[model samples]
Target: MQIVHSPLHLRHDGGMELHRGALVPCYEMPARAEYIREALVEAGHALVVPRDFDPEALLAVHDADFVAFLRTAHARWREDGRDGFMLPSGFPARGLRRDRVPSGISGAMGYYAFDAGTPIVEGTWDAAFAAAQCAMTAAALVAEGERSAYALCRPPGHHAGRSVYGGYCFLNNAALAAQQLRERGFGKVALFDVDYHHGNGTQDIFWERDDVLFVSIHGTPETEYPYFLGYADERGAGAGEGFTLNLPLPRGTGWDTYDAALDTALQRIADFGADALVVSLGVDIYEGDPISAFKLGAERFPQLGARLASLGLPTVLVQEGGYAVREIGTNVAGVLGAFGACR
Candidate 1:
């Protein structure tokens, strides 16, 4: 498999995040992608630099105003005389008026952000844009007839929404890839998110469309982060009814339990008869992860990849969340290598 990545991701380096009621080092650091890229290279996979893509690709899955905000947020924060990275102090929740975008950078941060964990630094926009480009380039390869490709995106997406950015994600890279496949004439595309956290942002982006089917298997919302959506009852609305499938597992879930959920998700995609597949490949489910709570061992990732390969569809694997910095590369490369062997 060809792995698409960019050194530009190094630009969005270090920052602090609000976690567990205290300021902590951001788990979503630049090392995540670097490690994965190095592993793919060591495994003899060709690393391809992402091609530049137009902003319209982003607009297909994200709001235009939100994109503009991401592009200028850091500059605005700098102009406002802020010294450190920008994090939202408050959110426009409950009774607050969210109909209007706030004028101040602080209020705007809250307006566009769903949580305080994602900080805005000077290189955020460029890094995020390049990540999206990596995803798009991988999707283009699959669309043009490659069997499968990997997009090693950093500042991982899947938690971001159309107008809101949070959970260490600024742009929804997986959603952009699925949309690109659709535009490239794939009659139907299936996006399967195997992240430990539910891909709430991806679900939100494709919630109203039937052409793209979204399926996710994650920790139950009652016990996990991003505790708003991801319930089994959140079926798509309107024309998208029954197009979404959420398999919420509990904490301490092991390989046996996860494999059952994966079977169900894979069956759903097979029934959908999708022409292309987008896997939001997240390795955070590993037992060693810091913030996540699933119990899949490093050895199980190859089985996960082989199962996905059983579908026999053109696939684009877009990198998502995984905080076990040291083992992340080996875990991810295991999946990709297994998938390549099966294919």
Candidate 2:
């Protein structure tokens, strides 16, 4: 299998994050990708760097204003002589009018972003851009008939929405990659997000399009980072109705329960008759994860991969959230290796 990555992703070293009501050094640190790259190298996975893509590709699923904000927020923050990472103070929730896109960087950031978890570092835009390229690189491989590929994206996406940025995401990498596949002549693509948090951004991006089937198995919003969405009942609307599936497991759900939900998700992808599978692979489900609640031990990762392979679909694994930096490699390698070894 091939692995796609870029050095630019390292620029997004997040500031402090809340853990058990105490601010701690960020778990979404630069080392997360470092360990993934180390593991991929050890596992003999070929690494490729994605070329720069035009801003138009990102424009497809993101508001132009939000995109502009991301590109300029850091620079603007620097121009303002603020040294700390740029973070938005408030967010627009369910009742707000999302139709009005902002005109300035700060206004745009506030308009699209959700909370303070995702701070805009000096090079966050470049890092987010490179991360998107990494995902696209994998999608292009699958489009060319590759059996499988892995995109080790940092500032893990699946949290940001069409115009919003938060949950440590800016450009929805998995959604962007899946969209690229559809635009490149793939008849159908399935986005299976196994992040601890729901792929709210991905869901919003593809909410009205049936071309991509979006499925997520995440922590119930009732007790999770993103508390507004990711319910079992928030199926897609319009043409995308019935194409979106969300399985919100409880806080302390273990491997057995997670595997069951994963099985059900894979079966839907099978039943959807999709030509490719884009997995938003997040190992935060691991028992040791600092910010998540699932009890998925490292040993259970291979089973997760093997189960996905049982569908026999051409898969593209895109890295997402997993805060336990120490075990990220083992869990990531386990999934990729199992996929490689599967018959």
Candidate 3:
């Protein structure tokens, strides 16, 4: 398997986030992707040549203003005489009478972010952009007929939405790859987000589109970090009718429950007959992950890869959340190794 990565990802360190009612060290640090890269290298996976994933490709899915805001938010924040990482504070949340966006940097942060958990550091835009390059590079490989490639992306992207950013993700890497395939002439693509938390961002991006199908299996939103969306009934809209599928499960789910959910999602992709597949690979489903509530153990990951391989579609694996730093590499490597065997 080819692994796509870039050193620029390390630039996005030293950010802070609001956690448990107080600002804390950000868990979605640069090391998350680096560790995966190191493990892949150690496991003997070939690191592929990274493509020049330009900004124009990003324009396909994200709003221009939102992209411009991210590129300039740090400097704009500095222009206001504050130099800390940007994190949102206020919201026009439930029962609020207005939907208009607030003005100023802080207000803008709140408007652009879905939560305070993801903080934007001075180097966030550069690193996140590189992370997209990582994903797009791997994706292009698969598009060119490679069976599988791994995008070792940091600032994992399952949480970012079309016009908003959160959960340590600034750009939706998996979604970006899916759209890239569509632009490159693939009639259909499927994004299977098997993260511990629901891929609210990916779902939102393609929620009303039919060209790319979005399927997610995650801890139910009723009690997850996202806290909304990801219901069983969000089966797409308009031309996208029946293209989106959400398999939200209760907490304490283990390998057996997750496997069943994956089975159903795979069957959906089969019915859709997608030309390519993007897996939002998040090992945070590991039993020991700090923030998640699943009981899947390390040894079960190889089976996860095997199951994904069963689909027999060209696949791009984009690294996502996996906070149990110690066991993370093992779990990720296990999946990749299993997939490698299938090929």
Candidate 4:
């Protein structure tokens, strides 16, 4: 499989993260992508820098004002002489006046963000834009007849929604890829998220659309981060009423249980007869991950890849969350390598 990546991803380096009521070193560091790239290289896969995609590609999946905010937030934050990273400290809650957006940078941050875990550094927009470009480029590869391609996106997306950014994600890369596939003439696409956390942003983007089917196998939001969406009953609404599926697995889930969930998702995709597949591949289900709880090991990742390959659809794998630095590369490599082998 060809790998699309960019050195520009290193720019989104957040220094700290709030975890369990304490500030700690950010787990979503640039090294995560580095390790994955190194592993892909060691496994002898070719890596290519992503090409520039039009900014409109972003607006295809996100709100225009939100995109404008991401592009200009750092400059606004610096103009106010704010020190350190830009983290939101306030938010609009239930029953609050949500009609108007505030003029100040702080208020805008709070207005546009859902959590403080994702700190915005000066280079965040540049890096996130590049990451989205990587995803689009990888998707274009599959659209042009490649069997599969991988987009090694950093500051992983899957949490950031149409108008919100959090969980270390600013741009919804997977959603962007699916939209790109639609623009490339695919009548229908299937987006399967295998992240440990629910792909709330992804679900939100395609929640009411029928063109792309969104399915996620994730930790139940009841006991996981982003504890709002991702329930079994969150079937799509409107034209998408039956296009969305959420298979919420319990904590400490291993290969057997995860395999079942994958099978169910695959069967749905088969029924849908999608033109292409986009896998939000996150390895955080690894037993050793610092912020997630699951029991998947490296040995089982290849099997997961093989299962996806069995579908025989053109595929694009967008990197998501996987925080175990030590084993992250091996785990990611196991999946991609096996996918290539099986294909």
TM-scores of the candidates in the order shown? 0.99, 0.95, 0.96, 0.99
1 against 3, candidate with superior lDDT:
1
Model 4 regions more than 4 Å off: none
Order the candidate numbers by TM-score, best to worst.
1, 4, 3, 2
lDDT of 4 by residue, 1-343 (tens): 8899999999989999787678888999999999999999999989999989999889888999999999999899989987678888889989876777899999999999998889999999989999999999999999998999999998788898998999899999999999989999889999999999999999999999998999999998989988999999999899989999999999999889999998999999999999999999999989899899889877888998899899899999999999999799999998998899998
Q: What tens digits encode model 1's per-residue C-alpha lDDT throughout 154-182?
A: 87999999999999999999999999899
Q: List the residue pairs that clash in candidate 4.
A: 236-241
- Judging by lDDT, tell me the better candidate of 2 and 4: 4
User: Where is model 3 poorest over a 10-residue stretch in terms of lDDT?
Assistant: 94-103
lDDT of 2 by residue, 1-343 (tens): 8889898988888787544456667778999999989988988887888967898889878888778878878777777667767666555668977777555556666776787667788888889999998998888888888888899998788988898888888899999888888887889999999989898889999998899999999999998978889999988999999999999999899888887897899889989999888999989999999889999888999998888888788888999999899789989999989988994
Model 3, 131-239: lDDT tens per residue? Answer: 8988888888888888898988887887888888988889999998888778777889999998988889998899899989999888998888787889999998888
- Residue 3 lDDT, candidate 3, scale 0-100: 89
Report the CA-based lDDT of candidate 4 relative to the real structure: 0.92
- lDDT of model 1 at residue 142? 89
C-alpha RMSD (angstroms) for model 3: 1.4
Sort all candidates by lDDT, best to worst: 1, 4, 3, 2
Candidate 2 weakest ten by summed lDDT: 101-110
lDDT of each: 0.93, 0.86, 0.86, 0.92
Error (Å) of candidate 2 at residue 77 is 1.6
Clashes of 2: 1
What's model 1's lDDT at 169?
93
The parts of candidate 1 lying over 4 Å away from their true place are none
Off by over 4 Å in 2: 18-22, 93-106
Question: Of the pair 1 and 2, which is ahead by TM-score?
Answer: 1
